[model samples]
Target: IPKTPLWKRCVQYTDILGKRLLKKIRLQYLQDNLEQRRTARSSNLLSLCRPTISLDPIL
Candidate 1:
C-alpha cells in the first residue's frame, strides 16, 4: 500500500477541521436567529420595523 505524503495528510486534516468548524458556526447562527426572532415576536407592535428600514446586503 502507498502512503499519503505529509502535506496531503495535513491538507486532509485541515479540510476536516474546517468543515466541522463551518457546521458548528452554521448551527450557532441558526440558533441565534431563532432566539432573536422569538424575542422580536414578543415586542410591542409599535416598536416593530419601519418601512424606511432596509436589511439588504450591499453588493
Candidate 2:
C-alpha cells in the first residue's frame, strides 16, 4: 500500500480537527440555548402565580 505523504497527512489531520471544533461549537451553542429556555420556563412558572403581566415578556 502507498503511504500518505507528510503534507497530505497534515492537511487531513487539520481538516478533521476543524470539523471536530465546529461540531463542538455547535453543541455548545445548543446547550446554551437549552439552558436559556429552561430558565425562561422556570420564570414563567413563577409568574403564573401573580398573573399581572404576559407570561412572555417579549410578546
Candidate 3:
C-alpha cells in the first residue's frame, strides 16, 4: 500500500493533538468546578452544624 503524504499526516496529527489538549483542558475545568462546589458545600454544612453542636452541649 502507498503511504500517506507528509502534509496530510501532519494535519491529522495536529488535529488529534488539538482534540486531546481540549479534552484535557475541559477535564481540568470540570475537576476544578467540582472541587469548588465540594468546598462550598462543606463550608456551608460546617456553618449550619456549628450552632447546633454548641447547643447540644447545653442540652
Candidate 4:
C-alpha cells in the first residue's frame, strides 16, 4: 500500500547489479584457470610422449 522512494529503489538496483557482476567475474576467472590447467596438462603429456634427440653427427 506504500510506495518506495526513487533513491531507495535505485540503491537497491545498484546493489543487485554489483552482486551479479561480481559473480560473473568470479565465474570467468575460474573458467580461465581451469582452461590453463587443462592446457598445461596436455602440454606435459605431449612433451612426455616426444623424445629429445641430439643434432650432433657424433654417435
> What is each predicted model's overall lDDT from 0 to 1?
0.58, 0.58, 0.57, 0.58
Q: State the local distance difference test value for candidate 1.
A: 0.58
lDDT score of model 4? 0.58
lDDT of 4 by residue, 1-59 (tens): 12533333344456466766656655766787778886884556545656775466886
Give, for candidate 3, the lowest lDDT window spanning 10 residues.
1-10
Residue-level lDDT of model 2, residues 14-46, one tens digit each, is: 646576665665576678777888788455554
What RMSD does model 1 have?
13.5
The candidate, 2 or 3, that scores higher on TM-score is 3
RMSD of each: 13.5, 12.9, 13.0, 13.8
lDDT of 3 by residue, 2-58 (tens): 253333334444656676665665576678777888788445655565655444456
TM-score of 2: 0.40
